[model samples]
Target: MTDGILVVGDISARAQAAVTGVVKALEKAFNAKDPIALSEQFALRTSWSNAMGTRLDDRRSIAESAAPAMEGFLCDSYARYDVVKLLEIAPNVIAVSVAQTPTDSSGNPIEGAWGATLYVISEQEEGWKIVAGQNTAVESSSA
Candidate 1:
């Protein structure tokens, strides 16, 4: 679906597949606990804001922090990433939102206001790379 965004227009099946692949790569990298490899998935000069508010503004910073930080929180957690929506904003750029639920090893939900991430991916000569991303907490509005 277009998510009611006229700018996205219509996407070809091939384009859709490529975008999906980028999402898959993200999950795979996280599951693998290889931060350096994960950073490679991003553009050389990228911006990433973690759910906890840590900001890595470039590939160098991302590679340095992502792995160490993730090791602590994700070591005993299991989460699945889902591509909630993909908006092709330009000829080679796509904005994506993903839904994820992190649970303990026993499948119990982790205590947190976290649920989704927003990403901007760009198609490079080799493949798609995330040029920017932000992980945020999902706060409830119900009182």
Candidate 2:
């Protein structure tokens, strides 16, 4: 990987903005602890792998499971998401990769559990939605 952020292919500013909006929206929903909203960002029949490598089979199950997961760790912490890269794979599809870190709500750093997520977004009648995604925990560099 290069030192600078790598954005491959051509996604116009507007399209890029919209494609990236999915991440922003996910961040907002997670921060707000709105699992329903968060799950709504995904495609109904698709799957997502959480940071723990657990496969979530569908939207309903994701939403069902996310509520408590949010309350458990996320509701008490502040999260930061950085887009590592975005690739335009097709006319109306793009893949986004992100780095995520979080601290306690008080801003105290929590050791470990850093994560990287990849989201494949596709255009829907409503807007862009995550057609597929995977979130995996990253070990500390010194680990």
Candidate 3:
């Protein structure tokens, strides 16, 4: 559905709530460093692939592999998303593009791996959640 306005459009209440839920859930999960909670935002058969060549399909596996990075090596600044746009590609599919950046533990800006995450969400009884995603890292920005 088109909102008629630029970024704001005629989005269904359920869809709007779903999008807001996903965004808030992610922000909280990352800030809390809770991988399990973070995994809940995705469906059981989600796929996460990054530019690092790491390709994983299972939600649990992705969470496990991300533990250390989310906990130690990286600064408290974890995965952050600046949603640029959202579009309903199909009746059951939604595509969202976001500008991602890494921050320090205090949530301060850091110069590191920066890229974009293009996610495709699917409608579920519980609401819309990510079913598949492709992460492209900013090669110029070193982590």
Candidate 4:
């Protein structure tokens, strides 16, 4: 999906919807600050790098790292994720680009907290799961 529109291609509508659905699920989980729920969107062997560049090798590790932050320092942090682009690299595989804007609990945007995330998702027996992801903070231009 790009700009709230799915990029038209040879991919099936069902596939597009499913991939988009996964991204929505992630947003939901993040807002809820449920580490377990958040990790559910990923595959068992997922590779994830947080916006701070901390790399986690699997879902368990991801959840483990998220628990304290979600319950402590980042307890009040919220974010909204928009799918900026989706590319079908191969059959049943999609590369998703997401724009993440930090928001308050009331869903109001927080300045200077923007981020971008790239997710590599694939269809598996359990459904669409993110296999790999990298999140990077968007820095303001000095110019």
Candidate with the greatest TM-score versus the true structure = 4
State the lDDT of candidate 4 residue by residue for 23-60, as single tens digits.
88988888899999899899999999998789999999
Q: After superposition, how far is residue 94 of candidate 1 from its true place, in Å?
A: 0.8
lDDT of 2 by residue, 49-118 (tens): 9876778878898898898888886557566666778898998788988887766655455775777889
Give the winner by lDDT: 1 or 2.
Answer: 2
Error of 2 at 36 (Å): 0.9
TM-score of 3: 0.78
lDDT of each: 0.74, 0.78, 0.70, 0.84
lDDT rank order: 4, 2, 1, 3
lDDT of 3 at 41: 76
Query: Where does the lowest 10-residue lDDT sum fall in candidate 1?
Result: 1-10
Best by lDDT: 4
Instruction: Give the distance in Å from residue 117's predicted Cα in candidate 4 to where it truly belongs.
Output: 0.4
Models, CA RMSD each: 3.7, 3.0, 3.8, 2.6
lDDT of 3 by residue, 7-61 (tens): 3444566775577568668767877888887777777788878556687797788
- Candidate 4, which ten residues in sequence have the lowest lDDT sum? 1-10
